[model samples]
Target: MDFLNPNYKVRNLLVLNAAGFSCISLVVFLLATQPFYLSDVIGVPPEKVGSAIGTLGAVDELVAVIVAPLLGTLNDRINGWAWNHSRFPSGSRILELVSFSVLALSLLGYGQFATKLFPDLWFWRAIFAVGVSGCMSIVTVMLHEVNNSDFRWSHMAFWRTQFKNHGERLLDGNGELDTDNGGNNELPTVEDDVFRIEEGPTQQTNKKHGSLAALLGVSTGLGAVFSVLFFLTLPVRLSSWYPDLSSKESLQLSYTLLGYFSAVCGVVVVVFAYDCVKQRRLSGHTPDLELPDTTYFELLKQGLDASRNNLRIQLAYVAAFVSRSTAVATAVFIPLMVYKFYYNSGLCGAEDLQNSLKVRSDLPLKTSCYDGYIFLAILTGVAQTVALVSSPIWGILVDSKKLGSRATLAVASAFGMLGTFGLCLVGRGDVYDPRTATCFILVSLLGLSQIGTIIASMSIVSSVGQTVERTEHRVIGSISGLYSLCGGVGILVITIIGGRWSDHWVFGPFLLLGTFNAALAAVATRRG
Candidate 1:
């Protein structure tokens, strides 16, 4: 609760950011586990599973690309209007609550509907996709507008006024007494007489924005942690609750429970959380809300124009697209590869494996290559958990100025390439069978490398936003939306082809596309 204090506003923002991202992470978790549910539970053909999930991912990302920017522009308009219309000040908060509620209902309905009629699973998938897509876009734009900008905007200005109203004393080196700690006190603090800078609070603003990379990275990673916990417990809990239900039925029921969890969280946020950014403006900085007269089409057009004209933005988009694609491709393909190994070993299909498990449950499950979903859950969980830990570590390192973002990106890219190349070996033949130790080590390496890529690329995007703000004078949300649009493009490009490649050879996509992308990214980083 103390962390939510005004003086520690950044901490409050990060926690809320992480909470919002958890919904998306849970969505990813469900999708990751779908491969097993489709093949074993619903009795779908093995070859078709890849295509279904891949197509679903492509559609999901496509919706996000189109909807995210439009929502961002809408948000700006709403904020501009709320400035003059004082009746409803928390416009963005209202949007968030509504978006989250829709997402919650979508998840709830999708789980129940899919479980009842497996053939209708695709329909549910589309509904959830659209819901989450719009939700993520709006949340992302809100975050960028709230914290990452260089300009103080209304929030900081409001805080300064609070200090003045409270009679807080601020002392400057010039021996002047000031009420607000907004930079008046710091003007005389500079010791450099020859290169005296007029702006005292620019450094302070930079300090906050500099941590933007880490803030976003860590928040996303923490959301993954919640997803890991849900997936790991879902299977066992479902089976225990409904002993009469078959394995497939139990899994379906699990999704229904997951929906409840997501929906409840959404409700909590809506009821308790005020829109922090808008509140700042409504408090004291009301005049700042009068945004320029601009249409969404105009904003979108300018964003597209800037993408072509600004080399920094272009480079940022390329880096983000490649990095996100590699991560998505790896996540989509790795579980399939592991399942193939287990299925070929014959234990995954054995009728007596459960009986054997009941007799000697102490035995290592991996020893028999049975119950592959458990391991799949573990592997994915471990990967996501690693992401959670590494994101902040890498983000802080990159943001600290100790490691240049480009150098960090190049190094991480090279590391990921090597690890992905190692995965190429896991699919060679039964002769190169994966032992438990071998699988864990390789998967952990992949996880560590993937987080590195995420943190580095995100840091690059933050720099891009700052660069655009300096030159374009446009609201940062549209540019942030464009960044997500590139990521959506990357997902679309890879999943459509990668899914087919998986059916042919489990590691084909990982070996060819993943490695090629890594190499290309490494080269680009070096040039930059």
Candidate 2:
């Protein structure tokens, strides 16, 4: 089947989307499980768990924001060189491979360190951040490369055909030349040309644009669900399978298994993504690639200019900032909240708590901490399931002329605002309380909002990136780099401040999320 780019086949696109799944699954698994590590394995106090997770994340996003821009431009340079030089796998693929290996190695090292060597954990996290940034930045560029001026590469190729004969021998619905024009072989009128130009993009372009958006949305949502559900449940599953191992031991075992799975996926990337970028097949010639070289300076300038001049691009970046923080940060914080409830209420961890001097061994081991893992898994599972179900909703909304891209974000941001603010009104999560159901409902709402923000922002960016690519072949790396940078800023702000606030109020991170979405809603609508 044909996709957006003629050079790359549908299989390559599938491979690219699979890489997204692989990277996101690993990253989400890390975020989902870290709180358990801090609260249980390391025996951090309940109040301090939030701060420790936050500080670690602050460092993660800090390194990410710094490296994203540099790697963004560097990716384009590597692609440019590869385009002109060799047929080997491009830099982005290599980047993805290296990233996956590094992330896997980081996970493998996490639990192996003795308690005395725990301070060295910071160094590994920084390494993990570099791997994550590389994966994200490269994926951003691939998404950008999938389109060019909203199907200009394909549409222009059609328009560049023999216009006069095309008009004279207009095809019927069955692809045969029609004689229905009463044998008149006149060229298309100026009015016809104007209509084609002014009627927005071609229907073919629209179809591919919406299709790709839907595909990626579902891919990401499914990846998150798979990671959260599967990895979060591993501890309990392992405990049941290995009765001799303690819950802490089960958790470490799960982490090690994830590292092995990630390494296997890295091997898959090398096999499939070795030579994805092909020479363009436009106008039966290679004039597009034969044009003047796109200097790094010009490419970088185009990215800055797009951000400075275009309101949609700016909104897309803002949406990325808020939406990414919403996506991954909440994965950390929500499970962290649930785990905290279990720890405080004596539902789990009598011996583990005492080992760290959290509490005296009083309540006789009322329940296993793996139960907390189960609940954490369930809550996140619900959120991502909702995201997967709602992924298509935003794609349809963005594709609609009546609602358009901007209006979709405006409406979706309202849902995000409602969901995040709604969390503030709910009590700290208790598995037994009737109010716990409300937490699920709010999480579902946020799930809907989460997928919306991503689809809307990505659809807009892809279209805008296409427009920019028309003037210059490779401006997307810098734009996507900037996109990651903004997201890093969002994570940095939410993690640092929300971590401190959680000590005082359990719902502090949700409150911050509500504010971000509220501001996004206002700006998105104001421009409309």
Question: What is the alpha-carbon RMSD of candidate 2 to the true structure?
Answer: 9.2
- Give the alpha carbon lDDT tens digit for every residue of 33-122 in model 1: 667667645666666777776776776677767776666566555655655565553434555666666666666665565542234665
Summed over model 2, clashes come to 1
Q: Cα deviation of 487 in candidate 1 (Å)?
A: 1.0
Worst 10 residues of 2 by lDDT: 182-191
Looking at model 2, the pairs that clash are 149-466
Stretches of model 1 off by over 4 angstroms after superposition: 1-12, 87-95, 115-119, 149-200, 208-210, 270-292, 353-370, 430-434, 463-474, 519-523, 526-528
lDDT of 2 by residue, 1-528 (tens): 122243333344566678788778878887887777765567776768788888888888899899887777666666666666545456667777887888788777665652322465566777788888878777766665564422232323334444554454456778776543321123343322322333343443553454466668888778888887777677777777777776667777777887787778777776565242443322122434423256777667777887788788899899988887787545877877777777677778567667776655653232367677777778888888888888777778888879877888888788888788888776654432312778888888888887888888877777753432354335667777888888889888998898788777767888998889988888888843
Query: Which runs in model 2 stand beyond 4 Å of their true positions?
Result: 1-4, 114-118, 148-204, 274-277, 281-298, 349-367, 428-435, 465-469
The Cα local distance difference test for each model comes to 0.57, 0.69
